[model samples]
Target chain A: MAVEILKENYAGKVLSMTIGVGDRAVTVGGATALPFHSFEGEVGNRPLIAYEVLDTVPEDPPASLQEELESVWDDPVKWAKYCQDEQGARAIALRLVSTDPDGQDASPESAAETVKKVLDAIDIPLVILGCFKEAKDGPVLKAAADAARGCNCLIGKAQEENYKTIAAAATANGHKLIAFSNLDFNLAKQINILLSQADFDINNIVTDPTASALGYGLEYTYSVIERIRAAGLMQNDAMMQPPMFLDLSSVVWKVKEVKASEEDLPEWGDRTERAVHWEAATATSLLMAGAEIMVMTSPRAIQTVEKTIDQLMA
Target chain B: MLLIGERINVITKAQRAAMEARDPKPIQEIAKAQVEAGATMLDINIGPAEDDGPQLMDWIVKTVQEVVQVPLCLDTTNLDAIRAGLKAHNNEWGKPMINSTSGETVRLNTFMPVAAEFQCDIIGLCLSGSGLPADANERCAIAVDIMGKAAEVGLPIENIHLDPLVLMLNGNQEQAMHCINAVEMFQTLNDPPMKTVVGLSNIANTAPMEMKGILTAVFYKMLVDAGLSGAIIDTLEKDFMEVVRTGDPASVYPAEHVEKTMKVMRGEIMYAHSFLEV
Candidate 1:
């Protein structure tokens, strides 16, 4: 089957962003073409994957992941260190999950402490995320941003509700911010615009157009990220040019396909292997759709994605 | 809508006094006010000052720039004044606007090179060697000629704005529709559509002062729907400007049917431009 290659000549380049300060600092974006259409324009930095670490310990981890993290699962700092060193992760994302008002309601001070310890342990860049609660996330993320100061870490989840405080914190501390908006590409651009309107530098902002898990409306996220990349590259739309973050773990983990037991359906293969493959598949799809940074939890999936990236760059 | 505020002109009796005194205060005040109300460019017309045109214009440019950094439209009949104004412009905000040139062969050599040299945005009038053509097709023929001359000077075609001059409805009803026709015709002359602009207030020139608002609202809506891109408008006229704002959501959208219909019906917003307020 002979298929003609359709190429697009785009007018703009995505904003090149570098997170972290020194040798381990990673750079993403600066691509002028569609994600991997190197046949036409340019794709500068390769996509990066960051391992997830929670401020509060997880109540339950799958047996496959549990056995690997037996020593560090209870402590975010040690878990972050383990991912950076032993797991050979590229970056570590510190999720302030306990800061949700409905959850453990962890103090901002404790989250800050967790951030400091984790920053100290990892040589790779750090990504500090917050609970979905807008009001609670601002103080918690602001504390985390302050703690990770000078590490050149990425701090955010700056939704419309809390972008001002988070933007202020990021600017004051000299860190990168992640502007989050529900899957609409325009909303993502609008939130970034609002942040810039408040005098925040757009170059330091990353967009999160809301990720979706594999087999669970992933196409929506896939299309939006593709549109965002096209808008930035083809329309010269500066508002949409910020590097995108497709945080993959939470959304991919909670889905049924990644959790269903093999015993329930004998024709299906091993459940653990299926879940890891699911993570790898979803991450790669988004990466190809123009996500520059992603967060995931599995070591095996990281290997799969690393191999995938090698083939893609080839 | 690409709105160019038309209030800073020296034609008005109040403005002439301020310019004559070299007072930057009132011009600054108008600049700030127009920007606040969302005028993208402020048209600076120093009317009929050929003797002191250059000196007066250079002064006004500095005066307006002192307060607001917004781009200024250099409106004048004097070529030397344009040169003086361009010299005085800082361009920190953006390119200065050449408030106009026409297809008239006699004026092209004078204005086009000035525009090309300074790379100012040029608003090209549809009037040719003989002056305002009888019909829309003739206007576009002149527009095509203007575009050719502009291209010869290496000015990007996109920067050219074509104003197919508006005529008063009271004297010639045929030319009223003809003006709107020219706007539509001019837009089709290029791939990216040459921008259509109009001195919006001129269409109501002979209208009774009380009726100017209604006349402008009705015809301005027609020109806008016919593909007017920019307008030299009084941003101070809130109702008329609002009508321009909501006239067409955008080109991809058909001219807003309901609002256009309402303005024609003389609905609630129709009185929005009435003389009672003035």
Candidate 2:
């Protein structure tokens, strides 16, 4: 007897979304099937990985990053250009960590100026992420969104505590918005619903279920992404249909495995490769789980994920 | 979307035997399994238990409730069975719902009053003494009558879920679009909005076994897009559940299969044994 191969027939599709303008504008999502199940349906575009660029040098920069691009780490414009021109990054995610009141406490005007500088240096799409301090992000993102207006950049990370100002800013500036929820399917859906209810165009909205690095609650984040994707495609839920965005760098860099030196744990092999693998592994796993776009650190890790995505798409 | 598990109906041989023997084990096991498989409600169907409906209905209601606490929909042509089920129902989950009443005057009169007295949700089939309405407008006409009659009986219009009635696609292909249109019409019927549901699997009846899954899932997407509120479906099918939960069939199913299903549903191509094979 011949054994039959069973296949799933999904009724819904993830919204294929495009960010930026002109030739460098990248489109993600629009999956007709689960990630890389192209034998059954259309998988539209390959996942886009954006290199993470910080507005200010981190207090604890990863050694791998320090060894590679120590020259441009302090300058956002040089850093973005290095990623775009040298590393061949598909997109750039500029984290305005300096704007947090608890951190460098840079003013919104300065953040906007930095955004203009970065936009001028790179032709690829830019994703502007705010210092997640709810109270501070509104004004900072509002200024940044206004500065990037008509560039069609993706302005993010509006959470429940402070979505109104950020969503309004993104809408007013004609930029895409990323609605962030704390690793729960219902919360993710609710934020998108709230955004759409406020007259923000549903198509331009991207969902962020919040990413966690490998071995640190990544499974929970993975499940939420799968559920969000399934709800968008299988349940045809309009609120959950937006392509997903995962921020992997922030969580990946903080974990002990990425930070521990080779001297401290000689059995774990080289510190630099170990850290790069940690970031690459996390990104690869989430790609399988339906992350349409991701923000990643470690140039080596981004290259590994890019090659993996090419093979998977093939 | 509301999913009422269709597995417990007595038309199936195993369930009919279980209901006849008054054995609660098989029936309760199925009930527990369906709830675990993601059914928010279950249809307890006794197919015209003309001889002992009242006793069986009461027994089954109490029996199924012992295992699962989800809401139940009492399904039968026997009027006494519906009353018996309600009388024995435990509302820890929710009040029991009537499986159906039609636009036929006698059925509307008999069940609407019972539905109102017990304050239960009811499925109002858009059908009459003459049989299923020919098109969406005719179905809407029957729906209006059913709504008006429910009002006259003091039943809340909100409690009535209008079913536009799905027909087998092989014989009645055009009725599929009419049913979808009717669901869209039913959604705009009232201010707070009336609910609409369908027997989702009915559209695939008599289709090849291989084709049933794709047909049901694709049509389900259409119904959901039309603003359907619920469906009585084979909730045990994992892919079907995925379709119901995600509401997108185009992404999971093969491109050719989805397109073929669409062509058949739209009546662009006649349904045949080779429809999917081609």
Candidate 3:
């Protein structure tokens, strides 16, 4: 008897969306089978990793995240340029953290200026993330989206509360919108449907179905991502077909394993290595769960993630 | 699951009486009830009681469509009756389906073009006349041939769903495993998997009444793992439909998800707040 491999012929493929313009532009999704099930179908693009940069000065972004880019930490443009030019970043995720109503409370105009400087300095793709505060997200994200016009960037995180204004901005600027739903499958689908109702085509969309840190309820996040992928591939669902965007570092860095100090807890191992491993492990787990793009902060973690991808995809 | 509810046929006592009287109420009630019970398609089979079978099939098709918005699966052995149902079909929902054809020479020659000409989907029974194949490999070959013939008539292979006939597992235990293998092999016939189904109630035809539901549901779950995408079953069986809904965990989840989903399957986790509520 011959042993046959269990391979699926997925009815639907993930929507392949192109980010950035010119030679360095990246295209993600287009797997007619499950992730890395190469015997059955083709995986069009490898997962993309974008180094995260903040518009506000980094008051504190974990000590492990700090040392990786100590030289470029002072300036957002320097940080974005350094990640693109020096680190060979295929994409840059510029988070407008200062525009939050409760944080630094910077005006939308200043955030847009930061966006313009980074857009002018980098040739790679950009994913502009809003501060996610309900009161100020509409104005700030609109300014950032307007600033990155014609760049073919991914502008997003349209939550239920502020999706209307963000959807308008993303469509008007001709960029993909990232709809965020808090770890619930129906809400993720509902928000995408909601975005489509606002006249944004469902194809020009990415989804963040709420990232959970590796140790803290990671299984729930894993299951949700799997459900999304299955609905798209096996079930031929359009609303669930967008490439998953795992915003890992924001949650991973704040977790116990990634932030606990070596001196504070010696048996937990080296603080820097542990944090890098935490980010890489969280990313790899989600990639297997069907993430197409991930936003991460540590260079060492990105290296490990690339290595893991190579090993699995090889 | 593309559940074609099998309870509307004149083979049942109430259905026969209603068809004999030319009354539309019973047919209409079954149509509305099946649709409400989560059936995507209803199979209309007008039995031999009526000499005006074609006209009655047309009436049944029209009556069902009036009550429900789902596509109808015209279920009859006679080509003319199938045509009448197809003629009366008002595709307010989508293209309707033909219950089936087989790799038998007469079937492939007659039914393939009817499906293509009408632009309707069909079920391809994986049989070539003598009987259900003794093994999975032979059944797969016949399914492939049926698909090829359907394609020759300009019917895209996807429009042809192959049903590797579900055999009675009471005395023929080996046939159960063969059906599972055939279902899995049907997927390899196309790049995106040719649709496949099991005539679910046929598996328990010889079993006792209480055992029928349990046996069919277990077999249905197994067939789903083997890539069965549709079924011809009693939609009134709420527990069976639930099995169909929750079938095939491997295709839908990671290992960790399977662990949690298994608990959901076993009723250990009732209010699972995840979007996995199929």
Candidate 4:
């Protein structure tokens, strides 16, 4: 008997959407087959990388990130500029952490100022993330969205509780919206259905099922993304076809394996190298599991993942 | 799962009347509603329309395609009617599917060439001219014949969908298991594995009216888990549609209903008049 290769014929393709404006715009998520299964169908665009730039300075930053970004920590514009210029970042994710009600409680007006300054400093695309506080995010993201209007930026994280105002702001300003959900396929799909019901163009939406670090429930996140992608490709589900977004930096940096000191655990290897490897491993695993847009910190980790993407795309 | 809506058939009173009157409102309304409710394809069954089958199929195909942008499955015993529907199809969304061809030599010889020429999908019924098969192995035997014909005509394996006919649960209980097993068997019969579809409601056809919904929904979950690809089902049933959308039948149906349905499926208990009560 002759050995024959079995290939799956997919019925659907992931909808590709472009963010940013002019020649610097980035398009993602148009895979007719599974992620990197290029022999089966067209894998549209390469997975994109966006460096995380925080609005507020952290009290206890990792040694590797602090060493690299210490000079630009206090200034959001300089931080974004350094990531864009020196780090060779393709895009920047401006996280409005100071707007958290439990933290600095920075007003929406101040968040808007930072957004405007970052937009002026970077030539690449921008992704405006919220403080993760449902109530505060509505106003802060709206202000930030207004400040970056017509920039074709990606603004997000419209959750189940506060999608109305954020979706409105993204729609009104001609920017794309990120629909965030917990680590469940149903919840992720429900958010997209809700946004569609609200008259938001389904093509302009990106799915963000919340991410977890490598050791901290990464498998659950991986399964959710895999299910979402299968629903889009195998089932031809219209609502689940949008590209997926993952915030690897926020979760990867907080894990114990990534932040532990070498003196505390001498057998675990060097602190800086271990942290970078942790971030890179989490990112590459999810990328294979089907992640199109990833927000990551640690310039070295970003570079490592970028190299891995090139190898996979090749 | 490719959810093919089963609402636009001539068996329904409104649909039959609309087809008789040549009215497009009632038919188009159901087509649009099914698409809105997450039906990727609609089955347009015009039952043995020996006389005006061709014209009726053409009109309905054009009518439905005008309003929505999903594929249509032209279902009838009339070959000319199937051809007319195919001719009238716009192909803006996708090619029209012929529902379907069976292992019977005449039907297979006639339709496989058309399916190959159009390069659209066609459902392969896993039965012979003698009637429905007795077991999964018998169904596979017939499927081999169908695949041979499809190959002779150069039909792409991906475009071929094998349907292991769903039997009623009230009496032919063992055949239900065979149907599910046949679906699993059809998947491995080809290199680029063949797709599978089922008339999902047939399993619950003779059940109590009140028990039909749970019966079909639970059976749908079983077929999906067994690797069945497409299902012709009532897409408007919210609970059943929930299972279709989320693929979590355990969450949508009641716990006892799911367990009872499983018992019947496994042949642990006979399907009876008081099946749900048991």
Candidate 1 lDDT tens digits, A1-314: 99998878788898989998789999988888888888987877888899988877676666556655667878888888888888888899989898888989989998898888888877899999998789998998889888888888888899988999999999889899999988876567668778888889889999998899888989999988887777678767677789989889879888777777788855767888888888999998898888899999888898899898988888
Model 4 chain A poorest 10 in a row by lDDT: A184-193
DockQ of 4: 0.02
Per residue, candidate 4 scores C-alpha lDDT tens digits across A110-177 of 99999999999888999999999999999999999999999989998899899999999998899999
- Looking at model 1, give its docking quality level: incorrect
What's each prediction's TM-score? 0.56, 0.55, 0.55, 0.57
lDDT of 1 at A217: 85
lDDT of 4 by residue, B87-134 (tens): 999898887899999999999999999999888999999879897799
Model 2 earns a TM-score of 0.55
Q: What DockQ do you compute for every candidate structure? A: 0.01, 0.02, 0.02, 0.02
lDDT of each: 0.81, 0.88, 0.82, 0.89
Question: Tens-digit lDDT track for model 2 on A123-199?
Answer: 89999999998999999999999999988899878998899999999988989999998886756866776777688
Model 1 C-alpha lDDT per residue in residues B1-278, reported as the tens digit of each score = 67889999888887888999988888889888988887888899997686899999898998888877778889989888999999999799788889788987877878998999998888999888785689889988989988999999988888889988887654344577678889998888899888889988887775557657656776777777787888888888776766666663232222454344333233212111221221
Q: Over 4 Å off in model 2, which ranges?
A: A1-3, B1-278
What is the alpha-carbon lDDT of model 4 when measured against the actual structure? 0.89
Candidate 2's DockQ: 0.02
